[model samples]
Target: MNPYFARSRNDRLAVGTFLFGTLLAVWYLMCVVLPHYQLSSDYVIYAHYATMTILYFQSLANFVMVTVARPDGNCKALQRNQQTESAHCDACGIVKPPRSHHCKVCDVCVLKRDHHCWFAGCCVGLRNHRHFVVMLTYLWLAAVYGNVLQWTFVGDQLGGHGPATWFRIVAPHVALLTGHVTAYQFFVAVMTFVGLLCLVMFSWLLQMQVVQIYHGQTQHERETAVTKYDLGWRQNVTCALGSRWYLVWISPWIPSPIPDDGYEYRTSAKTD
Candidate 1:
């Protein structure tokens, strides 16, 4: 594979910038722009609430990581020869490994059976799962933090005045005046709406993660339980995060298990 295609350092940097810009832009509007026009207090409150809600989502994502085992890289499609000791896969003409499955997206058999993630634009397989979870969870936290900062700053900027009093004071001067609300107020309302959406999505993800954790499966595994062996929660967690999580995360050179060449066919033959 081309190094560039596998999410290079520059790609990470670019994605990071986009995340920063997206979250910061939403926050800036809530903090500076909405408050300047003296928007509704409820808007700011919702933003603050949204900011704190992301912790749950991050935890949920971690749980999902454990639930979903990734596919191995040694899977191949085959025409079954029931009687043969060693069967050949016509698709790749290679033997499929034990616990391997063909990934339609990757167009190859993967070992271990983890799911693909389109949002990350990569497979959430063993090699990348840790970094993927870290990236996703951190981004979720950052989004929350930004909105929290936004609402808190907005409150500080506006002082302790009541919404009603401020609304009355700003009414005549505010643009886009409706019978019920001024332009500034409406902008804040919009910010609140966006914040609420974020909160809902995060919350739903959290709930799903918790549910899967309790059931001892990831979304993928839950769906494919009939064919796949559910490794249970403890093994799933250890395999994804590593048995020594502290060392796994800290060490830069720790090697992961690699599939032995032709073991796929050998294992399959024994099973057959």
Candidate 2:
């Protein structure tokens, strides 16, 4: 009912749509156009198809998890006494859990709040942190893969035996499709540029997330110099990625159970 919540939801929906649509378009390009032009070997073509399929579905699952999985934000259940100082949020008038911070955009407290991602149009917090990291990882991989494939295809078209010019390569595809350089080819050209940019950006993001997880810190916690939640590297990674983390990259469908409930977490001081 709140305007802030409404605006945040709308932004999330719009961004999510854009992201999902972009990925779907890339999948179509890779599965449909790529194999026809780039590969002569059946094995390579089939492998490309399989790669695109996994990336598409995994990306979709990650996007869904990031969008729908919200923190409970109910601090009252954890608070045994009304007078507890850390138990109350002044803004939302709810009990605040440890490591939770109030997100102005979402208008609620988020458990283990990392950062409010404008691209995701949501707060990166407890329940969806794993999903967020996995999304970035897969998206980066997809971008890198797309860039390499596009580069090779463009090079072959441009009369170069290896990587070569952009316009000289793309102009033929555009002209063949519509007798002249049409919007479709232009769109592909733009995506080629975007793919490279995303490859670099997401690579940096994934690296940052890995470093943060290794040190058992969220973006907020790192800024605030809070290390109470640092539970050693392995346990910290396990906490973020869940139990079956090794298989998380292969597929989002794989069961990777988060150890904590978001409301309750084990700090460095406690063993149990």
Candidate 3:
């Protein structure tokens, strides 16, 4: 009944849903769909698969980083300032550094706390923010690519590309029970919807994160129009991501470390 625990509980469900959906979608694409093109002597699928493989693996790596990286404000800087300053987090018993906030779910104060990602079951903060954004970007790209590859196939299976077929795709359960669609058809319908939904969701998430980073703001700071930290978009990007912001989308293994610890920040009034 405790409200504080609800988010954590939902975090578990979110993790399960994310993993299950990802696995199912991957199986459909790699096993079911790719074989379709292969059997038809469509060797061109190899090129498409290679790209999808890259995007999927890159996104997966960044996803792991976002979940595992600790951006909590537990370093010597914040730890030494345990005095009851106005920015103090009583729960963490430490004076939070600039842009830091306590995460009840993680039970720690996150440096430059953007927000909690329930599906990842981790706080997106200074350390993982770059990975989080990259994950979303790759996920969105893969989803868009997958949708383009599968749309024609799905339309054919549903009996042509028409609104009538779309209605059946939308009401897949009904089509399945009514014997209008096979079990495979039903599953494909659901997965099709899932792919589109993931594309749309990731699109919004990527846009939001990029805009916030572009303006040197977190989700909270964005709402407040906090322009003090609004260095040029390029500087803001390098601040959140790293000096090599342009190259992060290529891979997370690249060692592009942020310049400083999360303890201090530069303001627009003093970019020196």
Candidate 4:
């Protein structure tokens, strides 16, 4: 019996696959179903906005949850102590690089370890964090914007009725948009959905910008122990989303690469 199979590798693959499937299912339902049958305009709009907010919150929550390490104490102090070139992770038994954390489930030290995402069915580590973010941005907008478009179709289907019969006529359009869709139109539907998704994600990304301006923290700084926020907001943004978030799509946030042997495990030092 191979020990690696019984350890992190198998669990990671299984759990990761489950998460990926779940996200795919959700994407199908949100982007495909509701839009096909023509759900309510308000519902579609609300879902879009809600998804945007939720993604932002989820990203923030996931980042904070994993990187903070000991959420109870002065993480600042622990980080300060780790200022030397390298250190070990007590949990996963590896010497983590400067901004790395050990993931117990994956049983490896993930560089720039954000939270493990069930949506992508992968750890939001250095390798795929950007992809996951891009996916979220796409999914959120696809849900909301797509729904709004559906409402337009529903309205068109109804041919613009007046106040009295508007409610009655519009209600059916909503129902029709909600279900009975197939995979073929997915590409066409995704075009519209992706556009809206990008718009909303960009807007929220800007919002994260404004918040960071006042608080003076990057996504990376907020998550890890690299606390030199004095280097202007531009640098902070660059560090957070890479030097090119404003330029391209699809998880442009690039993380620093991890070392060859990976992080060392340090015994949790008992503080008196």
Q: State which candidate has the highest TM-score.
A: 3
Question: Candidate 1 regions off by >4 Å?
Answer: 1-103, 152-192, 206-218, 226-232, 246-272
- Which candidate has the top score in lDDT? 3
Q: Which portions of model 4 miss their true places by more than 4 Å?
A: 1-86, 152-230, 250-272
Give model 2's TM-score versus the native structure.
0.78
Please give the ranking of all candidate structures by lDDT, highest first, separated by commas: 3, 2, 1, 4
RMSD of each: 10.1, 5.2, 4.0, 12.4
Whose lDDT is higher: candidate 2's or candidate 3's?
3
Model 2: ten consecutive residues of lowest lDDT: 161-170
Instruction: Write down the TM-score of every candidate.
Output: 0.48, 0.78, 0.89, 0.42
Please write out the lDDT profile of model 4 over residues 1-272, one tens digit for every residue.
Answer: 11212244655575465445435534644565456555568876576557645554454343332332231122333344444566766874444465566556545555555555433333554444434445455445544544454555434443443552244333433333654222333333443344444457556764554554333343555544334433455543344444464642522333432221112322222221
Residue lDDT tens for model 3, 47-101: 7668877887887798887877776745567778643433877897778887888
Structural RMSD, model 2: 5.2
lDDT of residue 131 for candidate 1: 45
Per-residue lDDT of candidate 2, residues 119-199 (tens digit): 766778887788889888888878777777777554443344333345423344544465443455455555555666678
Q: Go through the candidates in order and give each one's C-alpha lDDT.
A: 0.46, 0.71, 0.80, 0.44
- What is the per-residue lDDT of model 1 for residues 1-272, given as tens digits with 9 covering 90 to 100? 31212144544564455445455555565456545555568867676546544443443354334324333432333323232334344555555544444555545554444455444433555555554444445545655665555564444433334685345335423423544545655555455445545656655654554444344344565565532323455544554455554443333235443222223311111111
- Candidate 3: residue pairs that collide: none
**True-structure Cα RMSD, model 1:** 10.1
| Candidate no. 4 TM-score | 0.42
* lDDT of candidate model 4 versus the reference: 0.44
